[model samples]
Target: MSATVFAGALFAGPVLAGPLRANANDVPLADIPALVLPALGETLIMVGIVMAVVVVVGVPLGAIIHNLARDGLFPNPSLHSALSWIVSVGRSLPFLILMVAIIPFTRLLTGTNIGIAAAVVPMSVAGIAFFTRIVENSLRSVPPSLVKVAKSSGGSSFQIIRTAQLGEAVPSLIGGLTINTIAMIEYSAIAGTIGAGGIGYVAITYGYQRFDNQVMLATIIILVALVAAVQVIGDALVRLTTPHSSTASDRRFARKVARLDIESANAASPV
Candidate 1:
């Protein structure tokens, strides 16, 4: 009898509990694209805005944090500690909890807390914290000898950082940017669950609540493809930026290669 009932439950999933098939509101598979595409665009816009903010703010902030350390160009223990603690606090909370926790702040800033604009606040906060660490780590991977050489050459602080530090770390930074962008895509979905509007909203409203298997499957496929495409593009960029071998000469050659690639790319591309 137990076996029979389990079989019945399995059957019920598609034949009974999935009453979406019986409902007048059931969406066809062909129409799933129509609904998901707009949501995808919204997700893209959300991630794009957050990434712009993350890059503009995260790079400088990461540089400041990195430079505050003992070995950094400028050491400030107090300021470093404060900033590190703040980033830690931001990283500690899960995105869902963070979203709820920052509702008042979001509303205060955006004057509302239920749209894409409202969602950008927490997303930017989380993205900035994550990308800042990525930038710091990438810069750390640069050889200290490079900085010394720059200083000996009479390079100014900003010049030393821009050339000896960030320039050498470009590949790692690109990889990190890819990871951060993917993360924001996920956050956009989470934001959608709370009515922030995106692919996540479609999944929640049509896929789960309505038990629409078609919409559920479509969203899953689209998300998988989107992520895969991003990963592929990111991996290619990383390869294009990375040195052929781990040697100073090889690194210089890689920079030349990257420069050529950059020249061919559209303007405003990352260095």
Candidate 2:
């Protein structure tokens, strides 16, 4: 009897749930394109604004921090320590909590605690701290000999940074920016909880609240595609900027051979 009842429930489950599906207001497959496009646009806008702010502000702040540290170009330990502490604190906070914590500042900046404009403030703030660390690390990784050469040439601190440090660190910096941009996308989704509109909002409103499984699935697919695209583009840029090791080695070998030839010729002469 128990087996029979189990079989009956299993067979009846789909039939019982058919009534719920009758509601035509639920997410339909045909409407997914229209629904997803606006959210995608909004997400792009939020991330674009945040990245611009991060590049403009974070890169310089990071460069300053790196330059002021011990053995840095400027070597101001006091300023470096203070700035490092602040960046540490900012980076330590969870982004969601950071968003809520900065509501007042967001409101002050955008005059409203809701929408893409308001979301930009906290997103940019978080991005700045994160990207600053990335930039600092990238600059730090630059070959010290390059900086020494620049200094020997009577280059100013700014000139050394611009011509040697940043120029050498381009590949690493691009990689960092790629990671930061992906992180901002995640934060943007979380921002949807506070009336900031995007795919997250759609997922929450239609998928979670209305129990539209199709909408939820669609949103997931869209987000995955977006992130994948970002990573591919970032990787391509990094590859383009990075020097090919084989080519570099071949050039180094050619230079060594040329130098040996010159030394042999000079030694053979009456010098």
Clashing pairs in 2: none
Alpha-carbon lDDT, every model: 0.86, 0.86
lDDT tens digits by residue: candidate 1, 86-169: 998988899999999999999999999898999999999999999999999999999999999999999998999999999999
Error of 2 at 124 (Å): 0.5
The TM-score values for the models, in the order shown, are 0.83, 0.83
As for model 2, its CA RMSD to the true structure in angstroms is 6.8
Query: What digit string (tens of lDDT, one per residue) describes model 2 on residues 158-208?
Result: 999998999899999999999999999899888888878888778878877
For each of the candidates, the C-alpha root-mean-square deviation to the true structure, in angstroms, is 9.5, 6.8
Error of 2 at 261 (Å): 14
Error of 1 at 160 (Å): 1.3
- Candidate 1's error at 187, in angstroms? 0.6
